[model samples]
Target: MVSFLFLDFDGVLHPQYDGEPTPKEVCFCHLPRFEAVMRRYPGVQIVISSTWRQQFGMLQLRAFFSTDIARRIVGITPTYPADGPPRMHIREWEILQWLKQHHASNKQWVALDDSQGDFRDYRHRVVFCQPWEGLSEHRAVQLSKALQGTRL
Candidate 1:
């Protein structure tokens, strides 16, 4: 009865403010806050659902977090074709694809992302993060509560 957490890096891990990019040194600044919440819920496993996965390998991606937290990140979602069918919720589609591949379609899961439109069809399954604030305490608390429920 393991729960899944689809993690996004750019907007959710660090501030990805509009008009300007975040400095590399300032990236992942909110990771500690996110890790703290994950620590409270050890049963929740994470999967990288960020675009960063397209550029970096799994090991490199995991290096962003503390060792303990890194291990909890089991895998990354499958990438979709850029020219595939027209769709508004590509992120949601990718999450479902990952769940299906793992044979965990029935498992409890949620996505942490800044783009609400990406999860329009499954709004209830997403813990929206503000790109300008990243994983603030408020967003972390929401994530904690989402994971607090008993696994189905």
Candidate 2:
């Protein structure tokens, strides 16, 4: 069975800060380490759960990663409709919606994000990243361990 990986760009792939960022804190600076871990899990497909998806086309988003990894990005989560009822854990809701829409609700899945509270109800499926450090060495290890423990 294929597994899903819900991905957030800011605060997960790079530093998320209120102040001006240093030159070294460029976007996707930590992607190499993330990609390294993901390489071991070929069965895992990615779904962008980040706000970046609202600004970029699928092809543009995929361009950020290597060709191999980019191809594994199956899709992006749909944003909640403005007229929809109020909801907490919106990101989690979006992921679930995607799963249902794709008829993949039975697939094993995990989300990589820095906003822990956003996935409070589904904490088990989230591998939280540090906002300032993004996918630091520690977060990378955590991701590996999470994947190893997953059904995938």
Task: Write model 2 residue lDDT over 1-152, tens digit each, in one string.
Answer: 33888999888889887555535649789899989999998988999999889999999999999999999999999998999998778999999999999999888788999987687667888898888878999888888877776422
Identify the leading candidate in terms of TM-score: 1
lDDT of 1 by residue, 27-54 (tens): 8899889998899888889999998999
Colliding residue pairs in candidate 2: none
lDDT (CA) for every model shown? 0.87, 0.87
Give the root-mean-square deviation of each candidate in angstroms: 2.0, 2.3
**lDDT score, candidate 1:** 0.87
Where model 2 places Cα greater than 4 Å from the true spot, the runs are 19-25, 150-152
Ten contiguous residues with the weakest lDDT in model 2:
16-25
Model 2 clash tally, residue pairs = 0
